[model samples]
Target chain A: MKELEDRIRQDGIVREGNVLKVDSFLNHKCDVALYDQMGAEWARLFEGKKVDKILTIESSGIGIACVAATHFHNAPVVFARKTESKNLDGEQYRTQIKSYTKGRTYEVIVAKRFLERGEHVIILDDFLAMGCALNGLLEICEEAGVVVEGIGIAIEKGFQPGGKSLRERGYQVESLAIVSGMNAETGEIDFA
Target chain B: MKELEDRIRQDGIVREGNVLKVDSFLNHKCDVALYDQMGAEWARLFEGKKVDKILTIESSGIGIACVAATHFHNAPVVFARKTESKNLDGEQYRTQIKSYTKGRTYEVIVAKRFLERGEHVIILDDFLAMGCALNGLLEICEEAGVVVEGIGIAIEKGFQPGGKSLRERGYQVESLAIVSGMNAETGEIDFA
Candidate 1:
């Protein structure tokens, strides 16, 4: 986590909308070494949990989730696909989510065969902002009667309500680096 | 490669329109252990190549690229973002690609900073069928002035023109499993 925080400070670009673009290491351009470290740390945190599978979303979450699965004894990773339109198939569990980054709503879908009843799933993602995407994943798990073992996030906007709301709900959520606050002018990042 | 071919035969669905859906292992629902093996194989194939980075597209390719990077000494992985419309930006290299699967053409964008001139880049992708996505990535490498060492494809549809055309052009293309033919009626897969 320290390494991640330091890397964010050194490479993260701050935009006007409280957006900390760690594209240098986190999102667009990925550091597999950093991802491996984070994955190992998540495995340590969820060591005792009976995690049957890892769930994440498409695009950004795939890399982190895939690497993190290695730490969990190579659990299968199931990414919920996002589509602008609804899927007519009744075979998939669907949930609508608002995109905090792109400022639109989309449906996140998972095939019914992927998640089943009584499975312990760990949800992983790159960024946790207002928690819309995570909520959508959780909704799919809930619909399938799967219990969420924990949530592992690479970076969390701590000033946002997502992390806080999950903790308040008694969910064990671990974020590699949590940005408590950001100064756009000074380019200084505060961590929690 | 034998394991991959076996997975394709067992779990891969032969859908209408010749779409071999390996959503169970390759794309949607990912098998992490299988991906680890894939990474090792890619590492073995690209042995001694000075690959500074692994380039791939968003969504499906990200997972494989990240895992594959581990075998390449933790080389960084950069994924191109797909957009419905092109954005005029001097700091990015963009390419237009037609997706036969998605039924539309989209623009894939990679920031100028991530891809450097003369960097040895290896393009990795899930499927090589028509080669639209792979060609788009290769174009980005060209615009960025990066040297493409080669392409590593998980599955190449040999019946299609993608692999044959790239091979004809003298590109060092390697496919883990090349499907020579597929029969939806008999549910049989022939690999070359």
Candidate 2:
């Protein structure tokens, strides 16, 4: 987490509207070395949970989730799709999730056959803000009757209430770096 | 490659309209173990070529790309963004990619800083048919002046012209499995 926070401080940019651009190493462009470390950290944090699978949304979450899945004994990864594709056939669990980054709500879905009942799943994502996406995953897990061991996130906006609210709800949410606040004008970031 | 072909035969389903659904272990629900083998295979195929980075489009390509990045000496992975986000502020290389599965076209963008000029990149994707996405990636690479060492794909519809065209164009393309033909009614596939 210290390494991640330092990397954020060194490379992350604070833009207008509280947007943090980590395109250099996190989201758009990725640092596999950093992701490997993060994966190891998640494996350590969620050790002994017997994670059967890793669930995450598409795009930003896929890379981190895949690397993290490698740490969990190479647990199989299943990513929820945010778009409707012709290849996505069969019965699926669908839910509406809001994306603060995209500024809209989209239908998120996962094939029903992928999530077996009584399986322990670890939900991972690149960033957590309003927790809508995380909540949507949790909702799908409940519908599938799977046990969510915990939630893992690379970065959390502490200024927002997603991490705090999830913790208050008794969810074991582990975030590598939490940005408490950011100043666009001064280009300063406060880490929690 | 044999393992991937076998796995595909075992789990891949052929649907109407020439759709080969391998969601059980390739796209929707991914088998990280299989992907690790794939990563190793790609490393073997592209041996001696220093792959500076692994470039992929988002959603389906991210997981495979990340896993593949680990095998390339932990080369940094950069995924093109499918949609505009608030955090994506900066100069970027943009291209329009047509998605057959999605039945639509989307603008793919990568930050200008990620792909350095003269750096060798291996573009990885989950599937290759018409090669629109692959071409978009090549376009971005050209715009960035990066040398595309090769293209790596998990599955290629050999019946389609994408892989054939790329190879004809003097680009080295390595695919794990090539589906020569599929019958939706009989539910059979012929691999090339």
Candidate 3:
């Protein structure tokens, strides 16, 4: 976690509206080495949880989730698709969540074949702010009758309520770096 | 490659309208172990190329690209995003390509900072049919003034012209599994 926080402090920048940009290593361009450490840390945190699969949303989450899959006994990484394609025609488990990053709302879907009944899963994401993506993934798991074992996140905005809300729901949530606050003008980041 | 072909033969389904669905293990639901092997194979193939980075488009490609990054000396993995986000406000290298699977065209953008001039990159993807995604990646690389070492594809529809076109253009394109044809009625697949 210290490594992540250090990397964020070194390369992450703050913008208006409390937006912290870590795309230099975290999102847009990924640092595989850092992701490996985060995956190992998550695996350590949920060692005995019997996580049958790793669930995440498409686009950004896929990178961390796939690398984390290797650490989770090569658990199959299943990412929920945000856009519908001709290939995704079948019975599906659906959940709607607002996109805090894009400032829009959209439904996240996963084909029912990927998630089976009674399977165990862990939700992984790049960032957990408002928890829209995480909640949507949890709802899909519930609809498919899958058991939610835990959640892992690379970064959590501590000033936001997403991580706190999940913890209150009795969900085992672990985040590597928690951002307490940020100064846009000074370009300083505070980690919790 | 034998392992990949065997897995494809076992789980891949031949759907209607020339669609071969390997969603069971390739795209939607991923087998990380197979991906690790692929990453290793790609590293071996592109060995000595000194690939500074690995590039791919978002969603499905992110999974394979991230895994492949581990084998590439932990080289940074940069995925071209399909949509614009608040974090991605900067000079960008853009390219337009049609999505064969989705029946659409969209601009793929990579932040100018992630890809610098003279960087060597290899493009990775889940599937190569019409080569739309690969071509888009090549265009982006050119825009950023980066050199594309080659292209690695998990599955290539040999019946299509994507692979041939790239090869004819003098690109080193390697595919783990090449499907020559399929029988929708019999649900049979032939590998090239």
Ranking by DockQ: 1, 3, 2
How accurate locally is residue A32 in candidate 3, as Cα lDDT from 0 to 100?
Answer: 94
lDDT of 2 by residue, B75-124 (tens): 98899888644444558888889878768888988888888899999999
Which one wins on DockQ?
1
For candidate 3, lDDT tens digit of each residue in A1-192? 999999999999999998989999988899999999999999999989988999998878899999999899999999998864434455888777897766788877898989989999999999999988898898888889999999999999999999999999999999999999999999999989
Q: Which stretches of candidate 1 lie over 4 Å from their true place?
A: none
lDDT agreement with native, every candidate: 0.91, 0.90, 0.89
Given candidate 3, what's the lDDT at residue A39? 94
The order by descending TM-score is 1, 3, 2
Q: Is candidate 1 or candidate 2 better by DockQ?
A: 1
- Model 1 per-residue lDDT at A116: 79
lDDT per residue, candidate 1, A1-192, as tens digits? 899999999998888999898998888999999999999999988889998999999989999999988999899999998776556879988988998778788888898998879999999999998999888888788889999989999899999999999889888999999999998888999899
DockQ value of candidate 2: 0.85
